[model samples]
Target: MRIIKWVVRLLVLLAVIFVGGAFLLPKETSVARTVTMNAAPEVIFPYIANLRANQSWSPWLDRDPDIQLAFNDVPEGVGAAMSWQSEHPQVGSGNMIIIEAQDPRRLVTALDFGEMGTATAYFNLVAAEGGTAVTWGFTSDNGNNPMFRWMGLMMDGWVGPDYEQGLNNLKKLVEGA
Candidate 1:
């Protein structure tokens, strides 16, 4: 009886520790990927400007086949907005709006995920080698949410690969176009 009581106590302690750790994790993280396209910045800006254009190469779009997405404002430049709703946890639900644009060069957007949180995404196109080098980046601050502290650790690994894949896909599509 004493052994069982000790075991129960230990289990409770462990649970408390785990919960505490989750609540204490860092809330900010970033992921970035770069790729070069044979096409000019003009050719690539369209893809970055319009969320609708993102369907051609966005890594996440293919993840949830049934996700409902809506776009508004300009179809392919500053002022564009895209929002999505999905039942899948992997897809979650969010909206992103174009907050900055330097035609054929730099594009920046603000993304909000309600309970999931908010983030900033950037796309930069620079001349490199024989083509344009495009870099995609995302960053978010969790505002020290107790439950979201671990997100920063998981985010780099989680988002990095997807960013790389998205860049590669963009390269292929723009090169082919």
Candidate 2:
């Protein structure tokens, strides 16, 4: 009976610690990956600005090759949108729409992952020494949700590799073109 009481107390203490720790976590999380491709921004911007063009380099497609993708009529620049559905959990259903486009410099998209919430994805192009530096990034507001706050801590590790692979695919596509 004494051991059972002690075990219950320990579990209660752990629950309190976890909840308190989650509140201390950041309210936002972001992940970004950059790659310098031996191509001008003008050359790379099209692939990013156009949802259809992105098909060649998007890593998620590789994860679920049979994933169904639907693109809006405006396939490039602002208002361009693409929604995808896949049975694969890693390539779950989501939609992304281009919200801002700065020609060959920057592009921003709003991404909706349904119950997983939404995030902002962006591409920034900068002229570098040998070519253009393309930075792909994602940012999510965890809000006041303790569960989301805890998950935010792992966002980078979860998303970074996919970004890296996507950038690498982009580099190969553009540089080889």
Candidate 3:
């Protein structure tokens, strides 16, 4: 009976620690990755602005080759969108829609990650060193969910590598073209 009481106390203490830790975590997360491609922004824009071309450089697509994808009628620019369904947990399911764009300079997208909620992503293109420097970024707010807020703390470590690989792939494709 004494041992059972001590075990219950220990479990209560651990739960308190977890809840307190969640309160200390950030409520938002942002991650950005950049790469310079040896091609003009005009040369690279199609690859990003066009949903079909965009998939060619998506790192996640490589994660689940068998995943199904649905594309909108408009292929590029502000209205372009794509939804993907994947049985892989890491891949999950999501839809992305281009919401704002400035020709070859910038593109902003809205991403809906099913139960994980939504995020905003941006692609900024600028002329640099006779080529284009592209920055890919995503931002999300965890709202009032303590668990999600805690998870936000690890978002950079979780998503940064994928961003780096995607940018690298984009560079290779545009430069090779």
User: Candidate 2's residue-wise lDDT over 51-166, tens digit each?
Assistant: 99999999889888799999989969999999999999888999999999999999999999998989999999999989999999999998888889999999899899999999
Best by lDDT: 2
> How high is the CA lDDT of each candidate model?
0.87, 0.95, 0.91
User: Estimated TM-score per prediction?
Assistant: 0.84, 0.96, 0.93
Report clashes for each candidate as comma-separated counts.
1, 0, 0
Instruction: Give me the displacement of residue 127 in model 2, in angstroms.
Output: 0.5
| Candidate 1 backbone collisions, by pair | 25-149
| Cα shift from native, residue 170, model 1 (Å) | 1.0
Off by over 4 Å in 2: none
What candidate 1 gets wrong by more than 4 Å, as runs, is 1-27
lDDT tens digits, residues 90-170, model 1? 678999999999998999999999978889999999999989999999888877565566667788788889899899999
Per-residue alpha-carbon lDDT of candidate 3 for residues 1-177, written as tens digits (9 for 90 to 100): 999999999999998888887778777889999999999899889888999997889988988889999999987999999999999887899999999989899999999998999999999999888688899999998887778887888888989999999999999898885
Local lDDT at 37 for model 1 = 85
